[model samples]
Target chain A: MSVLVYAENADGKFKKSVFEAVSYARAIADQNNTTLTAISIGNVAADELSALGQYGAHKILNVSTDKLKNFINQAYASVIAKASEAEQADVVVISNTFSGRGLAPRVAVKLGAGIADGAVSLPDTGNGKFLIKKTAFSGKAFATVELTSANKVIALIPNSYKVIENATGAKPEDFTVETNESDFKALLKEIVKSTDKVSLPDAEIVVSAGRGLKGPENWGMIEELADLLGAATACSKPVSDAGWRPHSEHVGQTGIAVSPNLYIAIGISGAIQHLAGISSSKVIVVINKDPEAPFYKVADYGIVGDAFEIVPKLIEAVKTYKASA
Target chain B: MNILVCISNVPDTTTKVTFNANNTQFNTAGVQFIINPYDEIALARAIELTDGGKGAVTVIHVGEAANEPTIRKALAIGATDAVRVNAPAHDAYFVAVQIAEYVKQHPFDLILTGRESIDYNGSKVAAMLGELLDIPSVSIIKKLDVDGANGTVEREIEGGKEVLTIPLPFVAGTAEGVAEPKIPNMRGIMSARTKPLTVVEPVEVKASSEIISYETPAPRGQVKLIPADDVAKLVDLLHNEAKVI
Candidate 1:
C-alpha cells in the first residue's frame, strides 16, 4: 500500500541519484495517500538514512549487513524482496543507474510486478489505472505504458525529475536481514577502480572531443578547457575506437549515456548515435569547423571555428569570470 | 560451465521508427530485424568463456516463430544450441517469466544479456530473471574475467566504476567495452543448421504492463548555419543565443 525506494550509496556516501529516486517515490506516495519509505543497503549509517527524511521518506529501512557492503546482485535482491514482502509495498522505485538497472527487474519478477525503466515522470493513477511514461529508443521518443498488474516497479531516469527537499526530520529504525549463501554462478574476486579526477557521468559540465580534434596528441586544448571549467572529459565513439580516448570516456549510443547540465562538443561532427546519447542534456554547445555539421542541428549554441584557437579563449573567459565572481 | 545467453530480435538501430494510424503499435512493415547489439555482446562473452572447451554455451529467445532466424544467428555465433519460447514478446515482466520458466528446467552456471534492449530500453529482463532464479546479477559490466570457480566483474558507476568478485551462477548485462562482438564465420554459419534448437510453448504468465501507444519523436528542426570563418561572431552567438558558455 506504500511506496518503497531503494537509496543507493558508494563508499558510505549517498549518490545524487538517491535523491532523484526519493523524489519520484514521494510523488507516488502522495498519490496513493500513503507514506514513502526508503531502504538502504551496504554500509550506510543510520544518520545517512535519516537524512532521506528531507525527501519525504517517512521512515527508512537500513539493511546494514557486512556481507552487503559491495553490490552482489543476488544478495541485494534477496534483501529487497524480503523488505518488500514485510512492508507489503505496492510500488517500488529505484534510480536508473547500473545497480538499479540490474536489480529492479529481478525484484519485479520476485514480486510478480510490472516494471517500467527509464521513467521520466510520475504515474497517472487518477483513472484507477497506473500509466507511466518512459523514454524509449535511447531517449528519442516517449512511450506511455499502463501497468495492469497490482504491484509495480519503476526505474526513474536520472536527472529527469526534480529532487524535492523539505524541512522534515525523522529517526529511521535499523533493520537487519539474514542473507543466505550466494547463489551466483559467477563469483566476484576483486574490484579495481579508476582514479580519474573527473568522472563524466557525474560531472555537471562535460567537455567532449570528437574526431575533429585531429588526433590524441592534440587533446591539450580540450583538456585545458575541461580543467578550466572543472568538467569531466568525454569523446565520441569514433574517437574512442580510433584510440584518441579511453573506451570508458566514450559518450554515445554505443558508449555511456550521459545527461549532464552542460555538454560541450569540440571538433566533432554529430552523428545520430552520438546525438542519441547526449540529446537529453540541459544545454548543448557544438564546436566544429564546418557550419553545416549535423551537430549544430541539435545544439542550442554553436561555435564554428578551429577548436585549437577557440578553446583557449573560452577557457580564459571562464577563468576570468570565475575569478571576478 | 553452462552459460545461458538471452537474445532479443529488435529493429536495427538505424531504422526509422514509425507508428500506426492509431498510434497504438509500432509500424513493423518493411522493418528489418537484427540481433540486439547488447545481446550480441552477451553471446560473444558466453562463447569466449566456453571457447576454452570446458563448458557449453546456449542461447535463448522468447519470441514468435519469425524470431527463429535471429535465434539461429546466435547459434551461428557459436552457441551449442538454441531455445525459443513460442510466444509474442510481451512486456518485460512477461518475457522474464517465460525465460525464467525455461531456465528453471535447465539450470545454467551463468546467464548474460544486454544491459537493455535497444528497442524498448526496458533494462529489466536480466534483473527480473535473476530475481526469478534467486541469483546475483550485475548490469552495465565493462570488464569481466573468470578464473577457476571465481569471477571478477567491473560495473560502471556515475563518476567511477565498481569492482566486485563473486562466485559463479550470476546474471550480467553486457554493455560495450566488455568484449568485442564476434561476427559469425562461414563455417559456423554453415554448421548452424545442424545445431539443436528447442521450441516450447509459453507459460500462462500474463503481462503486467500494457503499451498504450507508440509515437515517433518530433522531427528535428532545420540546421542553423554560421560562416566558418567568423569564429568570433560564432562565439558571440553561442554565448548570447545558445547560452551554453
Candidate 2:
C-alpha cells in the first residue's frame, strides 16, 4: 500500500499547493514505509509532472486526457478512483481548493474511505491509531480526528503546510486510464475569471477595507496599499452587501473564509462573524479611527487613526521597503 | 421538483465557544442555537425555486429530539414538510453517511445545504452526499437558478467565480449571494404547526473519525496605542516589531 497524491495542475502547470501536498504526503509515506506517488491529469506535460520529484514525489502517474482539460467533477472523481485502485493506495492526499473541495469527498465516497478536509497538519502516528488535526469552526479551533478505516482521504488546507524541497531527481512514468464521457454529467461551458490582481485565498498579505472607507469610489487608497504590498484586497461583509466590493471579496463567516499570512484590516470593527473568517491569520494589523474598536483586541498590531490618512503612509512605506529589499 | 434542504443547528456566530470538562465536546450552556446561516440561504433558495414551479420543499435534519425546535423553525420559514433523523450528530463523515442513507429512500430533484456548519465547519457533507448518490455537486455557490430540466449555479473560486450548468438532481452548498433568508411570515409560522414533521431513528453509522480534545485559541494580546500624528512611529512598529509591512 502506498500514498497517492492528486497533484493539481492549471493550464498544464502544477499549482503551488501541489508541492505542499506532495511534501505532506511524502512525510506520511515515510512514516508508513510506503512509496509516495503522484497522479497528474489534463494537459500536464510529462517533464513537468516529473519535476515534482523536488517535492518528494517518488513517481508521477501522468494521465493525459483531452476531455479532462477542464474540471468536471464526475470525470475527475472516476479517474482518481481508478488510479487509487491501480496503485493500491491506502492513503490519498489532495489540496483543499475549489477543485479539491468539489472532488475530494466524491473520491472518498468512491473509495468508501473516511475523508478529512481542511487538514492543517500531518497525522500523528506515534499512537497506535493515526489521527489528523484539522481546523474547525472556520479556524477558530482544531479538531483531532482518528481515521480508523483502512482507506483514508485527506484534503490539506492550502498554505498551511510548509513544502519540503529535496531536489531529488525523480522520473515520471506515463500511465493511461480510459474514462467514459457518459460519467461526466455536468459540463463546464465557460470559465469567467475576475480581473483582480491577487487572489484573496492565495495572497500572503491581504489589505481589507470596511465601511470606514466611506464609499467604493474612495477605495483607491486601499487598493494602492494592497498593490504596493503585492497583497489581495478584501472588504467587510457590510461593504460587499452595500455594493462597495464584490461579494467574492467579502471576508466573514457569511462570506468567503480566508486564512492569509498577513491580514491588515482597515476601518473594520471586528464583528464576531467577520473575525471568525480571518482570525487564523499569522499576523493581524488593524487600522481604525476608533481607539476602542474590537478588532484591536485580536490584532497583533494596531494604528489608531483614520484609514485615509494612515493607508497612504503605509503604502509609501511598503513601497520604500520593497524597493530597498 | 422535489427539493431537499438540509439544515444544521449550530451555535450562533456571536456565541463564545467553550469546551466541556474533558474538552471532547463543545459546551452548549448559555449558548443560543440557530439555523446555520448558510443553510438558511439554502432553505430560502429551495422555497423560492419551489414557489416558482409545481414542486414542494422538504427540510431534513439529523439530530436528537432537542434539535426539533430548529427543525420547526425551518418548517415555520417555508418548508412544506420536515424529517428529523433522530440521532446525535456523531461527526462529519458519520453524519454524511446517515444523510445519504436517508436521501436514498427519497429521491430529490435538487439537494441544497449550507456550505459548512458554523459549529463543526466541515464543508465535506454536500460533496460526500453527492458522491454517495453519484451526482454532480458544487460548493460555495452564491447564485442558483433552475429550469425544468437543467440548472445553473455560480460558485465562488479563489480569484473568480465559476458558472456551471448541470442537470437536475445535483447538489449545491449555499453561500451568501443565493438570497437573503426571509423571516417566517405570520401565516407561514402558523401553518408550520400543521406541517408534517416525521422523525425516524438513525441507521447504524460507521464512525471513523473521533474528536480527541479541544482547546481555545490563544488570548488576544494587549492593544497598543499610538498617537494619530506619529504615523511614522506606527510604520516603524509595523516594519520592525510586527514585521507585517
Candidate 3:
C-alpha cells in the first residue's frame, strides 16, 4: 500500500502548494506505515522531480506528455488514475488548487475512492476509522468527514499544511500512461493576463479595494500600495461588476476565494459573501471611511478613514521603512 | 438545444451559520435561503446562451422538497423550466449519480453548475457526473461562447486565464463573470409561476462519505484599532505584531 500525491508543477518548478501536499502525504504515509510516492506530468527535470524527496516522497513517477504542459484537467486526471494503478496507491493526496479542484473528483470517480476537498488536517486513523477535518459552509464552519471507502482521496487547501523538508534523495522513475485523444475535449487553447502583478490565488499578501474607492480611475494609489508591499491587487464583487477592476481580481463567495497570509481590505463594507472567502486568512486589516463597516468586526487591525487620504501615507511609510532597512 | 443548469439552495450570505448539539445537522431555523450566487451565475449564462427564447434552459436541484421555492426563483430568473430530484443531498457522489441518471434519458447538450456549492464547498459533482456520463468537464470558467455544437470557454488560472474549445454534451462548472446573475422582475415572476416543474425520484445510491461532526472556528482576538494618522505605528505593528511584511 502506498500514499500517492500528485505534485503540481508550474514554470518547471514544484509550487509551494505542491510541497505542502507532499509534506501532508509524508505524514500520512508514516502514520499508515506505507511508502509515499508522487506522480507528476510533463517533462519536468529529473533533479526538480527528485527534489520532492526532501518532503519524504519515496519515488517520483514522471509522465512525460508534452501536451500535459497545459492544464488539461481530463488528461491530468487520466494520467493520475493510471499512475495510481501502477503504484497500487491506497490514499491519494493533492493540493486544493485550481487544477487540483477540477482534477481530484474525477480521479476519485476513476479510482472509485471516496474523496474530500478543502481538507484542513491529516486523516485521523484512530479507532480504525478514517476521518478528516475540512472547511464547510465556505469557512464559516468546519466539518469532520469520514471516508468509508477502502481507497480515499484528500485535497488539502493551499497553505493549510506546513512543508517540512527531509532530505531522503528520492529518485525519479519514468512511468507511461496513455490518455485517450477524446479526453482532450476541454483543453486550454490560450492564456491571457490583464496585469503582470502577482495573481490573487498565489499571492501571500493581497491588497483589495471596493466601491468606496469611488471609481477605477482612482486606483493608482491602491496599485502603488500593493506594488510597494509586493502584494496582489484584488477587488470586491461590486468593484468588478462596476468595471473598477478585472473580474479575475474579484474575491467573494461567488468570485475567487482567497486565504492569503495578510489581506488588507480598503474601502470595503465586508459583505457576508465577501467575508466568507477571506475568513481563513491569517491576518486581516481593514480600512474604511465608515467606522461601522462590517469588515472591521473580523479584522485583526482597523483604520477608519478615507482610503484616498490614508493609503498614500501608508504607502509612503512602507517606502520609508524599506529604504531604511 | 437543451441546456441543463444545476442550482443549489443555500442559506443567504448574511445568515449566521450554527449547528445542533451533536453537530449532526445545520441549525437552519430562522435563516432565509436563496439560489447559490455562483449557480445563479450559471443559470443566468444558460439563459443568455439560449437567447431567452428558442432553446430550453432548465434548472435542476437534488434536494428535499422544501427547496422548490428556490427552484421557482430559478425559473423566475429565466430558466425555461426546472426539475426537482427529491432526495437528501447526502453527498456529492449521490447527487452526481442522480443527475447522471436523470440526464442520461433527458440528454441535454450542455450542463452547467457553480464551481462549488456555498455550503459544502465540495466542488465535486460536475466532474463526477462528467465521468459517469462519459463526457468532458470543465471548471473555473469565466466566459462561455456556444455556436451550434462547438463551444469556447475561458477560465481563470493561477496568474492568467486559459481559453478552451469544449464540445457539446459537456459539463461546465462556472465561476463568476460567466454572466451577471439576474433578479426576477414582476413580469418574469409572473411567468415563472406557470413554468413546468418536474419532480423525479432519486436513484438508489449510497453515500461514499458521511459528516462526523461540525465545529466553529475559535473566535478571533480583538482588533487593534489604529488611528488613521498613525501610519508609522501601523507599519511598526505590522512588522512587530502581525509580521505580515
Candidate 4:
C-alpha cells in the first residue's frame, strides 16, 4: 500500500503548487501508513529534484527523455501509469491543473483506478471506504465521492493545501518507460507564453473588474493596482464579452474559475453565475458605488464609493504600507 | 465530416442547490435544467464545422426522458439530430463507456464534449473516449481548425498555451474560446420538433465511484464595511485582521 505522486514542473523547475501537491500526497501517505515516491517526467537537475524531499517525498524517480520534453497528455498518462505499475502503487496523486485535468482520467482508465478530481479534502479512510470531498457545480457546492476500486487516483486542487517542509535525504533514481508512435500522434507544435503577467490560476491575489468600469480605456488603474500588489488581473464576463479583457482573464461559471487567497472586485456586481466561480476564495473585497450590489453580500470587506476615487487611494495606501513595512 | 457533440443536462446556473434522500441526492423539486454551458460551445463549434450541409452534427446525452427537452434544445441550436441513452449518467466512467459502446457501432470523424459538465464537473469523458477508442484526445482546447484529414488545436497550459495537431477521428474537450453559442431561431425551433430523437438502451458498465453525500459551502459572515475615505484603515485591516496580503 504505497502512494505515488507526480511532481509536475515547468522548464525543470518546480512551482509552489507542486510543493503543495507533494505535501498533500505526504499526508495521504501518512494516513495509509505507506511511503511516498514522487516521479518527475522531464529533465530536472538533481538539486532541483531533491527539493521535493523537503515536501515529504521519500524517494524520487527521474524519467528524462528527449521525447518527453513537451507535455503530451496521452504519453504522460501512459508514463505515469507505467510508473504506478512499477512501484505497485495503490494510490496516485496529481495536481488538478490544466495539464493534470487532461492526464488524470486517461491515467485512471489505463490503471483501472477510480478517480476523484478536484479533491479539496483528504480521503476519509476510517470507515473502510476511501471517500473524498471535491468541488462540484463549479465551486457552487461540494460532493463527497467514494472510490470503490482497489486502485485510486486523486487530482488535488492547487492551493487547497499548505506546503509544509519536512526534511528527508532522498535521492533520485533514473526511470524509463517504453513509448511508441501512438503516444506522439497528437503533436505539440508550438508554445506561446504571456511573459509579463502572473497567471490567474496560480495567483494568490487577484484584482478583478466588471461592467461598471465602463470601457477598456479605464483599465489603467486596475492594472496599476494589480502591478503594485503583484497580483493577477481578472474581469467579469461582460468585460470579456465586450472585448475589454481577454477571455483567459474572465472569472465566472463559464470562464476560468479561480480560488485565490484574496479576490478584489472593483465595480463588479456579483451575479450568481459570477459568484459560482469565485465563491471559493479565502477572502473577498468589494469596491463599488452601489451599496446594494450583490457582491457586498459575499465580501469580507467593502467600500461603497466610486472605484475611481477609492482604487487610487487604495493603491497609494498599499504603496505606503509596503515601503514602511 | 461527421461530428458528435456530447451534452449534459445540468441545473441552471442560478438554481439554489439542496440535497435530499439522506443528503445523498440532489433535490430537483424546483430546479430547472438546461444544456451545460460548455457543451453548448462544443455544439456551436460542431455546427459551424459542418455548416452548409457538409456533414451531420449529432448531439447525445446519457439520461432519461426527463432530459429530452434539454437534448431537444441542442437540436434547436443547430444539431442535426439527437440521441439519448436511456440511463442516468451514473458517473464519468459509466457515461463514457455507454457512449463508446454506441459509437463502436456508429462512428464519427470528430467528437467533442465540454471541458466538464456543470453538475459533476468531471472533465473525464473526452479522455476516456479517446483511450477506449484508441485515438488521440485533447482537453480544454481554445481553438480548433480542421483541414482535410488533420485538425489543429490550441490548448491552455498553466501559464501559457500550446498548439497541437491531430489527425481526424480524434476527441477534443471544447473550452470558452472555441466558438460563440448560437441562439435557436424561430425556424430552427420549428424544425427541431420534427428532427429525429432516438432513444437507446444503455450498455452495462460498473461505476468506479459513488457520491456519498452532498454539502453546501458555509455561508459567508458579515462584511466589514469601511468608510470610503478611510483607505489607510482598510489597509491596516487587510494587513492585520485578514492577513491575505
Query: RMSD for each model, in Å, please?
Result: 2.6, 1.8, 1.6, 1.0
Q: Give the per-residue lDDT of model 3 (tens digit) for B33-114.
A: 9998889989988888888465999999999989999999998888898898998888999989899999998999999989
What DockQ does each listed candidate score? 0.52, 0.66, 0.76, 0.82
Model 2: per-residue Cα lDDT at residue A19: 93
TM-score of chain B of 4: 0.97
Q: Residue A234 lDDT in model 2?
A: 96
Of the candidates numbered 1 and 4, which has the greater DockQ value?
Answer: 4
Model 4 residue B229 distance off true place after TM-score fit, in angstroms: 0.4
Fnat, model by model in order, equals 0.63, 0.68, 0.81, 0.82
Q: Model 4 reaches what TM-score against the true structure?
A: 0.99
Q: How many backbone clashes does candidate 1 have?
A: 18
Q: What's model 1's interface RMSD, roughly to a tenth of an angstrom?
A: 3.0
Quote model 3's TM-score.
0.97
Residue-wise lDDT of candidate 1 within B47-87, one digit each (tens)? 88888787899898999998888988889989999999899
lDDT (10s digit) by residue, model 4, range B87-199:
98889999889889888999999999998888877799999899888889999899999999999999988778999999988999999899999999999899999999999
User: Best candidate per DockQ, number?
Assistant: 4
Question: Model 4 chain A — which ten-residue stretch has the worst lDDT?
Answer: A188-197
Please give, as one word, the docking class of candidate 2: medium
Q: How many clashes does each candidate structure show, in the order listed?
A: 18, 0, 0, 0
TM-score of each: 0.92, 0.96, 0.97, 0.99
fnat, candidate 3?
A: 0.81
* iRMS values for every prediction: 3.0, 1.8, 1.4, 1.0
Best candidate (score: TM-score): 4
Segments of candidate 3 deviating more than 4 angstroms = none
